[model samples]
Target: MIRSEQKSPFRVYRGATIDRDEIEKLRAGTLVGSNAFFSSSFCEEVAEMFIGTDPLAAVSPCQSPVDRRQFVMFKIDVDLNQTADLIIADVSEQSNFPAEKEILFGLGTTFIIKEITYDIHRNLWYIEMVVSSEMFELKQEYTDFVHGCLKYTDADTLFGTFLSGRSSDYPAGISHLQRHLRKMKFNDPNRANVYFYLACAYRSMGKYEHAIEYFHRAKLLQKGLSSQSSYAYADTLSELAATYSLLNNTAKALSLLKQAVTLFRRILGANHIDMPLYYTRLAYVYWQEKQYEDAHSLLLTALSIFKEDMTSVFAGLSFTKHTMGLVKHALGQREEAISLLKETLEIRRQSYGDDHPDVAQVYYSLALIYADTDDKRIAFQYAQTALNIYQAKLPKHHPSLKRASELVERISSYQRESTLPQSEFHNVQE
Candidate 1:
């Protein structure tokens, strides 16, 4: 009966149905529950339990399934480091089937989905995840942001504010924001902040009209906020522009992005950590306009700023890489674009885990790029995976969701065509 406490950190395996996209994105800095299990023995888990950092901690082993279709085989790489007390035990000797090394976790234990991929040949999904220590740090970071936002607010409201923006819990986020707003008078100092976040929540959920209305309201109420502050009204302008960009209103997006960039640069100066964010946003809009040169220039500026101190602005750094990757592709730099995108993908996985809309966006871009080349054979797989993540989180009519769905259908048709006889293919084309 080997235990994690008596040994170094290891891995466990299991077969699971991905029922929810929101994994371990904490509710009020507390863990949501799961029935996931693990083991060190092959084929199935032993009954022993142990503790480690990764919720994906290993203490069990199992043999591969004979029927791939019947059981989804997963190769989950779990990273368990020093953080919290999550148990993983190997009880192979104690089990009736000793070959099946089983493991267990503490109740209410949580985890994050870092990355996911499909193996066509093995019929397996590779979920590359590093967790626990990272999870605790991430949660603490978000909780600190909540403290900074609402100094006197209740813990529930603090957690609610986190949901809409960071956790991708739009339903819970909106409910909390609406309730919080009702308690505030029209002239309350925090009213603008509430309006700003409410707009953010609505935008995240594809409620563009409501988002726009609230953004305008926030803007009107934000007159007293210092223009010099990095988190002032300028941020609202940038967000409003993003919502417009999603609706194909590039003109509005471009104008607002320019305004936000100017404010960030002139007032806040180039020293602010978020300076690159607006520049990248502008570059994204520029790409849509086919102003490739302008976009490239802005991306260069953004990337340089990001390289100064990468650790502090990890998310911004990844976004810069992601944007630059797309721009590189548009410039016909396919190899460089793919490389940058792959780097961005790993960085985002390490930073956000799986199930984030940002992660899905990366998958979406990679699929589009691959679908256009000789790698079109696997393009459908990438597209389908992206569509799954998008479906779990994004709204039905959201542009990203709509585009991913269309891409999946288009790629699926291509895949089906490849399976047809030459004569049949011609018939279908006709």
Candidate 2:
């Protein structure tokens, strides 16, 4: 814990004595040995890979290591960031001495940043490692661990695929992730983070209930986990709330969101970058409940914060504008609503491209605006565009496609009726 704290402004310890052998073992690439003890939190990313009904087991235990008896040697990978100095320290503090006994044991290699360098031309980071011969006795498992780490590092690429609107590539990476997560022991604090990301990936794929399960596991794993960060707890709370919202349990979502909001306010005060997100979420829930006044008030506040920060996150911007448009349209402020919608569409198109789901959503919103305004011609065009985009890119029978098709058909019918001749209308009337 001291080592983890050493890297942060909130650190409570400095110049504390560390076990000499543990330090040497950590420096020597001999992590995951039998005697390790983690003072920091586990990696949630690893845990999220296995949150649903375990294909092999019946009841899932909240505070236990997963049962991986049926699988072959498992691989584990962790992405190392310089800011994760605390994670490195915690892993070192928990490791075993030459003859120590502990609940969690690791027998894997380590790669420090000094011996690794990124090759710009090759677009790869290379490392120089020397494994201890004594540790080589567990060579096969160690090799699997190295393989697991390599595979886990590809999460960034997988996340990129998701952002680029290629969510299908995510599940393909799941098998590797599942195998890696299963191999991890109960004491691996790093696994907590692994679970969190895995939950995010699940949520991205619209596996809401599945995501909620993993999110709970991540929260459980966070207990007694050490960190240099007070921000970690608040981040988890916010994530869980968002997941609950996705599950359509807005009451729980609101409760959790408020808790997270208070935590963030405590830690970062009222004007933090994350503060607006919480407000935005609260506004959305209000909007869902048809509390237009409350929703509008909160959205205006969130938008002001966002504007002042001037931070760039296209998805967030698009969502805020789209929601504001909805609230305005509901309030019968069509001109304001149309302006916001146009801005949202332009921003999303520039950032995500015309074919992106978010871009399609903007068009869908515009179609609704046009539909309500009795401009069936423009409404039908936008609806058709949205439907075509969804049908070509998304899976068959996707809800977005269905909704878009419905809108198109509604407008088409309206258009046909409006264009009928007066003589024909009179004859039908007679």
Candidate 3:
């Protein structure tokens, strides 16, 4: 227990050595003040003397495993001053170790002390003498430990690997980080970020259901952290809406997308660089609903935003152009559609190389246009090219590969029928 002396200018309180279990009990809020060893008479005397006195005026010496001994002071508030029943003194100055002097250091800090009682089971002495700075230091150390693991194995490298389209490596990297975070008891806000990134990784791998699950988990966690704001939460909602759209849950997708748009507008403003991307995403959803006029208007706005930023060669620029081409084709502006599609295809090929899935998609679009124009030979060539790329890059039963394969067969059948005898050709065509 700490002993106190009443001096003229300041009151000195000396504290007892605390055990590990006692410290844990204090942190857990299981330690009660009534059980402290200090006498009621001693508590009342100290409380009366320090009633209006600043907590900084009283000093205590505390023992630390790292520094051996340190002097810590507290900024006592009205609650603490009124509740104080005993005085603790500085014990570190008596030791041969150097005195680490700090005065009025812990001002503005808050501490909670339970009501003092005479229960023998509770150690009130430790409660009265515990300095807030010591607890603060311990918490800071724990936060450092959790963050140190992230620095040791950089997340940026893993994110870069994911961005490079190495889907096989991406999940493993994020999963490893997630496991570490869970094991370390990371708090809600940081954990939510991890879940959000995991959802994005799953989306990139075409696992829309898994992406939706993680995105929902992230959203719930984000909501729990009411004091914190996360920009990534908005992005997660937008991506989740896209996954819903892929699953043909159009109603849910539109609702979530609208929420995402509102959040992005609130957090980043409408003039931010990311605004055009969000607009483009909404436009694509409208396109899927076959609302060509609405989609076209959104695309025009996105294009204007991109042009204002002078980012015409950006990847989003190509994506917006590609969607616009599809919109034009659906509107029966075949000539304009072909020109836009060709421009998008060239941009994609230059940005992602010829073997990329995006390039293959463009090839499929070109094949469709040529087939509609009655250029069967050119259509067949483009379809074959698209099919080869899809078969190499995608799963055998992927929808894209199936579509490309079907187009190739249809074009081949047409070519064969056109070459037969006139009567035979008519019969085969029919």
RMSD of each: 10.6, 22.1, 24.2
How well is each residue in 1-430 modelled by candidate 1, as lDDT tens digits?
3344544555565554332223222233333334554432334222122211123534222223233222223333344545345555556667786555555554434555555554444433345433254445656787787676566345555666688756878888989989988887777767777788788888777788999999989887665556433456788889888878777688999998888888777777876667888888888888777788998998898888777756558778877788788778888898998899889888777766777777877777788888877676566677787788878887777766777887777777777775311110000000
* Cα-lDDT of candidate 1: 0.66
TM-score: model 3 vs. ground truth: 0.55
Candidate No. with top TM-score: 1
Best by lDDT: 1
Off by over 4 Å in 2: 1-186, 223-233, 417-430
lDDT of 3 by residue, 1-430 (tens): 2223332233223223444444444542222232333311123324323323234533233323223332222222222233243234343345353142211212233345432222122222323333234344545665775475465234543453345343334446556656646664556336666666677666655566777998998887665234234556677778788778766677887788888889888878886777877777787778778888998998898888787786333567877888888788879898898898899888877667788777777788878877776787888888899899877776666556777888788778778886411110000000
lDDT of 3 at 233: 67
Candidate 2 lDDT, 170-289, residue by residue in tens:
355444455557877777655666576667666655566766787778777665444423455566677777767655577987788788788778878887765776777777766665
Candidate lDDT scores, in order, read 0.66, 0.56, 0.59
lDDT for model 2 comes to 0.56
Regions of model 1 farther than 4 Å from truth: 1-146, 151-158, 227-231, 418-430
Worst 10 residues of 1 by lDDT: 421-430
Candidate 3 stretches with Cα past 4 Å from truth are: 1-157, 160-190, 224-229, 311-313, 418-430
